[model samples]
Target: MNLLDVRKRSLGVSFNTEGQADIYVWSPIAKKVALVLPDKNKTISLAKEDMGYWHTSTTDIKPGDLYKIVLDDDLERPDPASLAQPEGVHGPSQAIDVNTFKWTDSNWNNIPLEDYILYELHTGTFTPEGTFASMEQKLDYLKELGVNAIEIMPVAQFPGSRNWGYDGVLPFATQNSYGGAEGLQHLVDACHQKGIAVILDVVYNHMGPEGNYLNDFGPYFTDKYNTPWGPALNFDDAGCDGVRKYFTENLLMWFRDFHIDAVRMDAVHAIKDFSATHILREMKMCVNELMQQTGRTHYMIVELDLNDTRFINPLEEQGFGMDAQWVDEFHHALRVTAGGDRNGYYSDFTGLQHLAKAYTDAYVYDGQYSPHRDKIFGIKAENNPGKQFIVFSQNHDQVGNRMLGERTSQLSSFEMQKLMAGAVMVSPFLPMLFMGEEYSEPNPFLYFVSHTDPELAEAVRKGRKAEFAAFHAQGEAPDPMAEDTFNESKLQWELLNQDPHQTMFRYYQTLIRLRKELPALRQLNRKQVEVVPNEEQQTLVLHRWHDNDHVVCVMNFSKTAQQVSLPSYSDSLTKVLDSAAPEWKGPAASPDQADSTSAVTVQPESIIIYTNHA
Candidate 1:
């Protein structure tokens, strides 16, 4: 059966042809199930059907009506497939007709994954209002910034307003605080109109601790394995079909109903499934079917720490057909090269050499022994295309998980921040910019949450403390439950009008424009790229070519200026951009031109770009 037909026949609330509410739920353990309408003070018993399913249709209920499911006339809970939770996670699920939204993106075909310049943002802290409406107001700003795609953090309904969004409980319900279901549709439709694609982050490995009633309905979790968050989802257990179907429906709901162009699955490595057909492969097959049926393109990107290329490999080769994945190795190596502390995971990376490896090969630990992991970790991704990996210098986890939550702007000098931006933009892999990285926003992206349960809140605080025990000498971690922590993480939008921030913003704009327009940089063919690392001088040179077009990027990570030899590919190379030039307020300007015969003096902690055509 098709995904829509399957959803309508066996899940929460779907309207029938006669305009009545058709309710279905899966509960093998419930001897009796009834629909309870608290507002109307009414009860309707559902008839038990095959395969642990219950069914009932009612003319009294309509869209916007709040209702709950009562199991065996005892425990009451929200619908597992709820489209809207107007109240909080603990409240009743509201019936929402997703087709009501008037979409204006009929001609909006999605951009190719190769052309994507993604900007990752947390909806809650991207703006002061922290709602879908507020986010829509900044589409023009993002468009001007040259990012064709925006990857929003998870919006699934959590316990309260303030959260990093990983604590989401209801996978189908939109966060009521963020304007709920209709609000998200409006934002997505607006984004499409501006020639931008929206990618939503989703978590399926584990549900949140509070208000998670999936176990009360059926065997949605398994004791066979555990996740850091909580009990692992029952993807391979006896009743695994119901659990798999539940998430498969959620995946389709975002693309089919909400019109999301892509989904960035959060932490697929944490999902434990020993089944012959892995859950990720199953989901990819379903997505392929949906894409064929709709005649539109959609993608599934994953946040995976495992350097396994099997996840992104083609399904015909007995692998999961994921379009792309975030590569954290690039971030670690780049940070260490920029003089970051060599502690924790940073200890595994040895500065310039590892960074150069990440440029050529997608994984720094590809089939190599890892001292930090105490064993050989990660298979080689040598055969994977460059577009299959996304690289970034700073992201939410890289910043927020720290004790101080210090951003690259807070840790490095102005020159170093610009160098990091150039490093990411010049790589062969797809590049992503965190919320305020373009303008060098000084505020920290700290971890924050607002759970109604005090014990759970305290537990989160203690967990943060324990996670950062290595940095105990720095200071006590901020209280995650405090409102101030969330407020402090908000992006300082006004900083763009200031000094170095304005210069940094212009630098990023130019870099993105160059990446889009330059033939050598725009092409993502890894075979045409060469990275030469000079460990002695703490510098690296990246050379890229497409057809006859050639460009070179030289990055100096040292504390002093270094004389670097130019490549012999072209007789004369013209300077395109200099991060150390007077326009960007650097210490001093470097030579504007260089050839194979003459060495160029590169400024300390800066990047200079040269092109053959110029």
Candidate 2:
């Protein structure tokens, strides 16, 4: 079944069997709405319907037609739900037949959340060519790296060629620089063929400041609520059903037309909707219905800073019931434990105890008072499954948002990097790796944008500096408008063949493979894991087990070798993995010969793992 077969198509350009196009747009305040066909030099007036939707039918319009809407015949604007804005944000919208692209993977089923080892990459910076075709060429490499899913950063049509893609104005249009709609479809098809699921990042918080035409057409923005970008979207206000329907259909289009397996909703906390059912809940219900009809599993992963478990809780418990959400607490706890600078948000995460808490308890701030925000932060997420929280050591936001955009490879020693990698891959939560993190790519992922408006460009430069000022770094932020900054952020793929980089890359590969092979490690139960933190020695021990099978991880955060007392467990043990092993470019040490009462000597700032021998 296709997108049109599942549910009635909402606000967009849809074609019928006779090649006639039915144009439906919602503009309650506009006294007049007309479709202007530039190629044929014809105009068709749409009659206003009962609920503020303007309707018009025409047989002359077909796929690949270039058209625009005239509001009251006095002003012109592109469609808010445009599929292909080939001419950029200021140009005409292009018609597309969603059913044209043929998919080869008819038997593709969704990857279960427990099996996801996600790899996130920005489309423009992931490769030298930085297009969809270029991204497709690297699928073999990603598959070999043992990542089952690729979480692409937002690729919705934005202002110019270079952007993080959060500033997209036309939500439906694919960026022209990245090969447009056909390009995205090609990447999706290729991913499915390689047995990899694609998770697209989407921004629903606010529209970008540039080329925003939604407000001109109707009451899309509401002054009733304020957001960091602008006024909140009109979700519960008058004529908001149309606004909700526009975004809801957009979500379904990605799944139905593009065959996307999942989506990572960007900053869902900022989507303030006071309706009886929030927008996130509505999206869950809509995707559920779509899944039932098509027999294809579709899921939503949210990026929420609020640390509320309600987002992943079941709907019957008065929660939103999302599939998963990003857990920043894990990053904060792990980063600080690895001797990272304690500044800004990092100020709140202190001591090695937090790391142990993260392993046993789902969140460290479960109802605890936060000194950084001067209030209690987060609720207990213990009831939820471990896979509901996605954890990453290095990601786009963590790297790009930094003052120098330095990755973990730049901040810590090679052994410490291996320790961080071990913690991420071995934990019960879902794991994700930023591009080039497996090989320790040196190039920084700096923030960059290519806005045509000089004023907006200058504002962006100043805004980035002001935003990072609280960190009190020594140097100024990189200029967002500078082409050199964008060039510097691209990954150096050649480093994978070098000495230390190659060793680190192999270490990550081994860890991912072992995690998959070990049944005890694959389980996602918090109760099955035990955290024992020795604060005086600056070391932590995590014991994970399932079905009488057990694995223990001992980590040393201090600068000197320390003897870690093995936890009192009845199972016999043998060393399985070690960060300080000579093969991983670490100091050589013999394997531990110890019972439950004996202690094992660990190298400075390294991790060692042991599995049950019985």
Candidate 3:
């Protein structure tokens, strides 16, 4: 069946072409189901349909009406497929007609995945106001920064106002504090109008702990497997059909209703399904069909710990046809190269060589034995196109998961930050930037939440403390339940006007412009790139070519200056960019030219780029 048919057959309140509302809910176990309107003091009994579905059609209940579903005359709870949780997770769900909003993106076909320069931001911490409307004001700035897409963190309804959005319980509803359904639609419409695509982060492996009422209606989770959060969603177990349909319809809702260009599926490694046809494969097939019908490009980018090529392989090859995935190995290797502590997963990477491997091959471990994992991990993804892997030096998990939530700006020198940026920008893979990384926002991105239950809140606090036990020297992990922690994570926009921050911002803009304009940099072909690593000198040389255009980047991770021989792509090669240039506030004694005839002394912790055609 098509996506619209699936959404109609599944649970949730949907409107017909005539503006008539029809409510369909899956509750095989419940003997009776009734739609309860709390404000109207009315309860309407729903007729039971085939395959354990409860259905009702009504003109009396219109958009903006508050509602709850009662099963077997029990306590009233929000709908499992609520479109808007306007009054928090525990309160009644508000009915929303998605078609009411006027969209102006009729001519906006999404850009290709390879052309995407993604900027990921958390809604609560990106700005002081922390609303969707507030984010719309920053579209001009993002467009100026050369980012074609923005990936918003999860917005599903969770308990209270403050959260990282992973604790969301209502998968279908937009966060009420973020201006609900209308606000998100307006933001998306504005984004499309500005020629920027929107990618929404979504979690489907496991639901959050509190305010999760899916179990009360049906068996949405399974006892067969356990995820890092809790019990895994029932994808391959008994009564899995409803569970799969619910999530599939949720995907369609975001693409069709909200106009999201892509979805970054959170932690696909934690998703366990041993069925013949995996859940991911099924969802991709549905998405493929949807794309054919709509004539718009939509992508599924997964966050996976496993270095498996099967996820991104073609469907005809008996693999899940996902468009792309986030490669944490690239970040880990890049972080270690930039002098990050050798703790946790950072232990597996050994600076320059691993970073070089990440440039040529997407996965650094590529069938090698990892000391941190204590086993042989990952297969080679050398054949995969660079566009399939998204690389970033700093992301939410990399920065926030730290004990003090130290960003690269906090740990590394200014020169090192520029070096890292050049390394990522020069690579063949798609690059992403964190919210405030452009100007190096110094504020820590700490983990924070605002759960109503005191016991659950305390458990979250204790869990955060216990997570950092491996890094023994800390006084205490920041209290995740504290309002101050959330406040501290907000970006300092004023930093862009400051001295070094302004220089860094301009440097990033230049790099992005080069990445977009340079033919060698714009092409994301893995076969066209070559990496030469010097472990002795702690330096990496990357060479990329597209037809007659050639670009070479020299990166030095060492604390001391190093003499490097320049690659002779052509005699007419010109030095395009240098981190040590006087305008970048670098050391006075820096190499002025990169000539193939003689070795040049590169400044410590810096990068220089040379191109034949620029």
- lDDT score for residue 229 of model 3: 90
Ranked by lDDT, the better of candidates 2 and 3 is 3
What's the lDDT of the predicted structure labeled candidate 3?
A: 0.89
Superposed model 1: Cα runs more than 4 Å off: 1-10, 16-18
Question: Global lDDT of each model?
Answer: 0.91, 0.87, 0.89
Residue 24 of model 2, lDDT score: 83
lDDT tens per residue, model 2, 1-614? 11223464556677876777888888889999988889999888888886678887788778999989889989899988889898899899998877778889898988999899999999999999889999999999998889999999998889888899899999889898999999999999999999999999988888888878998888888888999998998888887877887788889889988899999999998998999999888888888889888889988999988978888898889899899999888899999999997887889998588988888776889899999989999898878988898999989999998878898888899889999999888898999999999998888999999998999999998898998886665688889888888889888888888989999889999899978877778888888998888888889988888888788888998889998988797776888788998999898664755558878989988888888842
Q: What value of lDDT does candidate 1 attain over all alpha carbons?
A: 0.91
TM-score of each: 0.98, 0.97, 0.98
Task: Name the lDDT value of residue 241 in candidate 2.
Answer: 79
Report the Cα lDDT for residue 180, model 3. Answer: 90
Q: Give the C-alpha miss distance for residue 390 in model 1, angstroms.
A: 0.3
Clashes by residue pair, model 1: none
Better of 2 and 3 by TM-score: 3
For residues 486-520, what per-residue lDDT tens digits would candidate 3 score against the true structure? 99999999889898999999999999999999999
